[model samples]
Target: MTTPLPIGSTIGILGGGQLGRMLSVAASRLGFRTVIFEPGADCPASHVAQAHIQASYEDAAALRRFAERVDVITYEFENIPTSALDILEALRPIHPNREALRISQDRLTEKTFLSNLGLTTAPFADIPDAAALDGALQTIGTPSILKTRRFGYDGKGQARLSSPREAAQAFSDMNGAPAILEGFVDFSLEVSIIAARSQDGQVSAYDPGENVHEGGILRTTTVPAKIPARLQTDAVLLAAKILNALEYVGVMGVELFVTPTALIVNEIAPRVHNSGHWTQNGCTVDQFEQHIRAVAGWPLGNGERHSDVTMANLIGDDMDRVPALAQDGACALHLYGKAEVKPGRKMGHVNRVTD
Candidate 1:
């Protein structure tokens, strides 16, 4: 087992979004301070972190200074530039490892990796150009999605093609970026497993959560997913296999498509996930703190769910309902201190304990 960092140590967090904001709060609860490195000024995490470094990710000098202050580094998002990682990683350890980030950063690479691990993923083909789109379509077929290879999230950088004629438009939507064409799956429901692995290779996973998405953005996640007992066991084991394969430390979100015969892997997020937010109310140790604990080299926490919980994201106009949500005693509100309220922006989330 890796030696746990002593109390009062500082953890460096990259990306000052809501996930980083909640991570900072969780670190504080464990007697650890957090220093946030974000390019944007007054980011959501800056409000609660011990210190915030406002500089671009590629700024070498700023990264050096930030690394010098913290004992370990972790990121809330996966799209961090390799140049920035080269600098910070040379100075301090970054948990979940760069390999995990590298694989998850690209759709093609991620699918290949999962398949190599004896896992099932949607039929995928590389689309390097418009010409490749036609050839890819011949194999993967229509009613598929064309997604950029890198830096896509929350339904962005993707176009759906219903037929072969739409292939040209789908490739055009990519704006000449490298892309992947994925065949559609006949899924009964969507579910995700939130798993954590300690430095010593100990792994634990929370119960799978059934998810609902609207306009390509996650809307709600409910624990005690309506899956059969056998499938639930398969979900947990498959998640553990991923953690082991990556030799990963810290938490990972594994999204899956539940089919009649098998569970198909959709994608994997290398950090705390929106789908796992139900853990906040259902489990004694939520995904955020579990991530902090694992990266800090602490023993993994008990992630067993004790109650049924449904978590709903507050997007755009959803903020207006906060008043009514606050009055409900069973609801736990977690609002990100983001200043602007734009359409489709994730402002906050509420977890309602059902049991």
Candidate 2:
């Protein structure tokens, strides 16, 4: 077993988005300091972290300095530059590890990994060129979605085709990037399990949460997913299986599709996830805290839910409703300190808890 980080040790976090902000907050609560290495100035996490290194990921000097300052490393996002990671890994240990990042960074790789594990996922094929797209369209059929293999999230880099006639326009949307064609699944609802694994291979999973997405952006996630007990158990077990396969030492979000018969794997996020936000008010150990604990080599915390929670995201202009949302005594709001809120951008989230 790896030694747990001392209380006052500093943790280096990559990316300075809202996830990093929340992770920093959780680390502080655990008596650890945090430093953020993100290029963007005045990023959300920079506001709360002990220090912020505003430099490009290509700056090996900056990455080395950042790594030297912290005892361990973790990241908020999966699309981190390989060069940046190479430098940091040589200096300090990175949790959730490079293998997890390598798999999650590419859609094709992630799906292949899941399928190889005896997991059910959307029927998919690699699309490296127009010919490959045609080949995939022939086998996968229509009513499918074309997604870039890497760097896609929140519905970006995705194009839908109702028929092969629309293939040209859909493939054009990829802009020459390597893509994957995923046949749409007929499912009842989407649910996600937020699971964590410690350094010693111990695994724990919070109850799955039902999710709703609009315009490809997550809108709300409700705890205690409205699924059968057997399915719920299956979701948790599948999540644990994924974490253990990767020897993942951090939190992971596994999204699944519930069909009439079985659950299909949707995708997995290597870092803390938006759908797991309900854990803030619903569980003793929220996902962010659990992530920090795992990366710090501390024992995984009890994540049993205590309250039923429905978490709603405040997207872009939705920030206008903050006044009304704040009036609700039962709602707990977590706002990201983003100065400019563009359309579809996440500004904050509200967890409405019920006893």
Candidate 3:
């Protein structure tokens, strides 16, 4: 196993979203310096990182410089360009590795990988063309969803179909890109497991948190998910299986659908997840800290929960509630430093911890 990067070492981060912002905060707590590489100025992560690389992901010269300056690298999100990774990997080590990124970037590849590991997922098929869509619809059935093969997140690039006529419009919405048609799952509730794996392959997972979404965007997460204990255990086991399957060496979030008879894999985020934000106040070690430990080769910390917590996302205009939420007892408010409150945008979140 590779030795952990010691305290005071610089860690490179690939995205500048809220996830990167939280990772920077956690890394600082462990005495590590962080450098953020992103194209946009005034990104949320740029506010907390030690330094910022204000350049595009495809800027090879800048990427090389970033790789030279950092001891190790990790990303906050999965949508990073593959070519950018090639340049960074040549100069520095990237945790979770490129294979994990490639598999998770495409919906069909992720579903196939999970199925190969003996995990249950929604019935799905590749949609290569309009003709293929007809066959896929016949097999996967209607009242399903058609998702683009790549770059889809936060309910984007997905279309719902209640009938055959809707399939063509859905395909057109995706601009005939590589896509997958997935049957809708009849689930009782949705939950997610936040898990970490060390470089030596040691793995640990946190309790699944129940999730509720608004307009397809996550709105709230509550710990001690109301579900059978066996299903909860299954969630953790499924997350471990995914981490092990990818030989992943960082924090990963696995979203699952708990049904009457079984558990079905929904989607996997190969990094710290928004749903796991409750961990910041609820657990002994938050997902962000665990991610830092795994990528830095440090010993993973205890993930025990000390409190019952509920996390509410401050999306768009919800940021206006910060003043009132901050006044509440036991609530920790986190603002992402985003300038705009555009519809559907995530501005921040608040966690209420109850002992």
Cα-based lDDT at residue 331, candidate 1: 98
Q: What are the runs in model 2 whose C-alpha is more than 4 Å off? A: none
**What tens digits encode model 3's per-residue C-alpha lDDT throughout 45-129?**
9999999999998789999988988999999989888889989898899998898999999999999999999999999999989
Which window of 10 residues has the lowest lDDT sum in candidate 1? 151-160
Q: How many residue pairs clash in each candidate?
A: 0, 0, 0
| Segments in model 3 whose C-alpha atoms lie over 4 Å from true places | none
Better of 1 and 3 by TM-score: 1
Q: Positional deviation of 310 in candidate 2, in angstroms?
A: 0.3
TM-score of each: 0.99, 0.99, 0.98
Each prediction's RMSD over C-alphas, in Å, is 0.8, 0.8, 1.0
Residue 341 CA displacement from its true place in model 3, Å: 1.9
